[model samples]
Target chain A: MRDLELNMVFDPSEVLRPSSFQDAVETLDSSDSKIVAGNTSLYSLARKGRLENIKKLVDISKLGISYIKEAESQTSEEKKILVGAGTTFQEITSSSLINGRPEYAGLKEALNKSPPQIRNVATIGGSICSAVSFYDLPIVLFALGTTLKFFSKKEGEHLITIDSFFQNPALYGKSLLIECQFSSSPNSASSFVKLCRRMSGYAVAMTAARIKLDRTSREIDDIRLVIGAMTKTPQRLNQVEEELRHKEPSIETITRMCEKSADLVHDIIPSVHASTAYKKRVLPILLREAITTAVERATER
Target chain B: MLNETRIKVRFILNGESRNIECMAADTLFDTLRDSLGTMSVKQGCDFGGCGVCSVLLDGRPVYSCLMPTWKVEGSKIETLEGLKGKELMNLDAIQQAFATNFAQQCGYCTPAMILNAKALLERNPNPSVDQIKDALSGVLCRCTGYMPIVEAVMQAAMMRRKKTQV
Candidate 1:
């Protein structure tokens, strides 16, 4: 079946290049119209005959949304980074603004998950909208508390939290994702860990953790723990976060909580590559590593 | 019957401007191998998983198999064909190093490996062992165990550096 799909030819009828957001939205409103950016996933899907219904291809690469800049935050105490949807993983990984910053360490690691070839063309917007469970960026972005700005014919323009967006991505179908913004706070850092059979291979289990430490108390003030590649969608381990909050971070306590949380995980999607038992066994180790690195970075800041 | 729509795509290939009409869904891999006859861009995995179809797009290495033909409009593309020397005896530094170091076995992945190394050398004149590994990690080479390829890239970087000093 896979070989047959690979041999199939994909030929679309028309390709539309929209220069403005309004024009893109209008084109997307038409039936059987789909947006193409990077063309990494779209081309593969088309070759596999998954996009047979897609007749009109709207090339949104020229929509003028490829950018990464610092935006003024609502509060003076916080700093926000706005990343255009069209920005590729390579761009994000090499950005001086994102690199060397402890707050964005997890994002940089996630962006480096893919090799140079894929990273050079795969855009962040496409990665998020695709909503593939095993993708590294979505899991890290969720832990970083990212918010998406999308445009639809009905809503015009609105912002949705990354958490909510992943919960029901189909609800925002036919909408144009403009950009994503995440706030960076002082004494905060993030880390991502993935266990793959080989380098750059699909993750059997992965975890992303972000920690915000109280400057005075040096305690874990707030934390976000997200685990992926073991389920249909990345899930947040709220119980573990609640257990660690306002407490001094230690290897023993974190290991204990993560181990307990791993046992509580149910409904794990089995894979031919990795068994459910093996994934469950390693989930706690990945969680401990991610949290440990995040805590270490937060303290260093 | 399938609806067919072809449009003219203009790009600079091998330092020469080219304009070709192709289907809306045609990938850069198809345009290069079928339309332009640049056979260096091998077609391995139609998807982006395999890097045998790698090429330099505007000085950055990308998977040509995953790039749409329309996306390369007005951009610069370079493949192994463009890196060859004018004469048969003379070869590009990377190519010469690969030949001397026995970098290739079956030679199927040589073009992509050399092209990826070329891009890395152009960006960083002197790359470390880890840097070379990171650059060539995308291209899968079943033979030679990759040590020879890494040595070849390192040697090529030195050769280029010596040439500039002279």
Candidate 2:
């Protein structure tokens, strides 16, 4: 390790600060460059000698992408929150557009999972591009059914769902994520629960659930459950969601379904901190807590 | 190919404007300690996990180890050194509170703790205990057990509020 550290140095040839969006795309398409925003994860990778491939570092923080605003959706009933790619977690958490609404409680919880220092600098675009499973934002955003906008060299501009983006993030390596939009509904509420060894540490098992309840029936109208830190990418509990979809979620029924969640999870990634068995045991508890909280919040709405 | 290109970045440090040349990949922690001779910015895990290198960038607390130096161009950067008043003997209210409350033991994490506290106090002068803990969550201190640090920040907040009223 010492020898590797001595040999691997993060000495990029040049750092380009593109003044315009078009200029940034041209630079990224023409050269062996990487987009740097926040530089939180990039610096960590550099310290571990994992960023040896890049030649040029393109600083994209100056491209003027930091913002948060509510936009009109195709359907007048659903409102979409548009967040700039360069917007930091702190900005997202403190934004009145997100904070004032109870439907986005899950996102607020997930963003607050990180320490203030990281929240102050780490951008949403950087987190999504990194595609690390331990990150809380991707999992919560996935449950919220977020859509990402990107500008690529080959494809001028396009929008991809959060689910598809996580499946193969490497496909869009050269592309710049411009912004992300997630819809907020009146009847829906989301919640995120993570169990870790220490405060602000990497998750042992984390779960995010978003549920919309039928107003009169009080049954589960729609649900999305995503579990992270157990796989290379965040996995959705489709089996459990299918069982709970149309049925009225009770404390007992949710508990029973989540207990069987361990069997439904496949490709459990091994961790240095927690054993596979322990994660399996803890997965159900996290799922139960997340779903219960989300259901309670949704009912209140 | 190994790139040795250097970049010149200008930013306001404390109250003064300064310019320094460094590698494009160098972190703010590196430029502060190695280049500009700001030794209070302690290097811990070098990863964002440890907040020993915490500093206020544009009045917001951020891990200096994680911030690329060039990103601070035209922004304000504050460290523990900047907390001192015009006279060397005058310490910021937060520092004075920390000294009286026994917030430091090894003193390695004190600079970061103080800076994080300063940022918190600046934003919310009357922060609750939980709020103070949340703000100080970034900086990890092996000594002090954290209670003293929390007390110091609360006391400093009171001192500031009293001073402003007077």
Candidate 3:
């Protein structure tokens, strides 16, 4: 379809740039109206004649929601960072709150490692909303236990966990993702790793982990592991998490649990681009690397 | 079912504010090449796969081919068309560096390569080797291997710093 950009094309009937977030949400009244933040992926689909039926284009880039807000957390005394969906990858990578903090190093690395051009224009909201398997942010957020907030004309606003949102992503009806909030815990250490042809290449398999260890006993208090790209959606290693917690934090223990993660993964989506065996083979390697990094970074006191 | 609509988008092109009518589906690559005649933004892959269609959107390097024309409304767009000196006979440091370093063989990707280099140098006047590679990773240079391109960006950076000192 790259060849057809100039030859064959049909335009949407109207392009609306709403002045406010509510106005942008109200534009969803037309089921055919599609919201465009960066238009990196949507325009590609439209050029390929895939979304020929979309009549109206909703522009939400002008909304002031493209920001990163840091405030005290309700769940804990620690501060939480609220990343607006409209925040660009460039902004995320440059923000002191997100990139400057050592705990968010994995997220910063993931955002910075993407194709420099794509990173400049792609927005966090657009990435989560599209929820394509190839995206790097979703897997990182999965391990972070991020909260997604949505707004709609009918529903007003509702908050849901990213895990639940991933479960039934299609349930997003006519809602717009408002922001993604995740806590910053000094005791926890998080790491992200991607396995593919290149840094920006589509993931053959990837994994992320956030681990917290008890200072006195040096035993694991909490662990969240997630694998992506190999599955239809990023799969959380709940079984592996249960196995690793309360165990003494050690390379031997972490390695065993990471190897066990291969069994916890499900529905490894086979594709012509990447064979199932190839993805499965790389899955354990990614898991071990991410988990090891998380373990090394975890504070004992 | 089918529909058609054209929106008038106003943006600063190269340095001048301009307005153009385009279909909502029209990409920045198409509008720059077809309507406004800013052909420097080449269409190498048309899709986002190739960086030959790269442009600086508000001083950030992005693939114009994948971006809708309407997305640039009320924004600054820098293309190779504006990468020049005071006179047509003169060229900017990046342009001269590429020429001196022999960075262009096919010349198809030169415009975007230079534009991307310009954007990178603006933010990072002195970049490390890995930083240079990461910045140019998107813009594919099939000919005249990356050594020359990398050298050109470094030379441009060195020249800029010298000028600042003087």
Question: DockQ, in order, for the candidates?
Answer: 0.58, 0.59, 0.56
Worst lDDT 10-window in candidate 2 chain A: A1-10
Which prediction has the highest DockQ against the true structure? 2
Q: Give the CAPRI class of candidate 1.
A: medium
Distance from true location, Cα of A215 in model 2, Å: 1.7
Give me the candidate number with maximum lDDT. Answer: 1
TM match of model 1 to true structure? 0.96
DockQ of 2: 0.59
Clashing pairs in 3: A85-A125
Q: Encode model 2's per-residue lDDT on B77-104: one tens digit a residue.
A: 9988888763647878998898899999
By TM-score rank, best first, the candidates go 1, 2, 3
Task: Name the candidate, 1 or 3, with the larger lDDT value.
Answer: 1
Alpha-carbon runs more than 4 Å astray in model 3? A1-10, A72-77, B1-4, B86-89
Q: Write the per-residue lDDT of candidate 1 for residues A1-301, one digit (tens) a residue.
A: 0122333445567889889888899997766888887777887787768887777889888888899998954576578989999999998888887999998999999888788888888899998999888988899999999999998878877999999997888888779999999988999999999988766767888999999999999999999999989989888888889999998999999999989976778878888788888888888999999999999999998
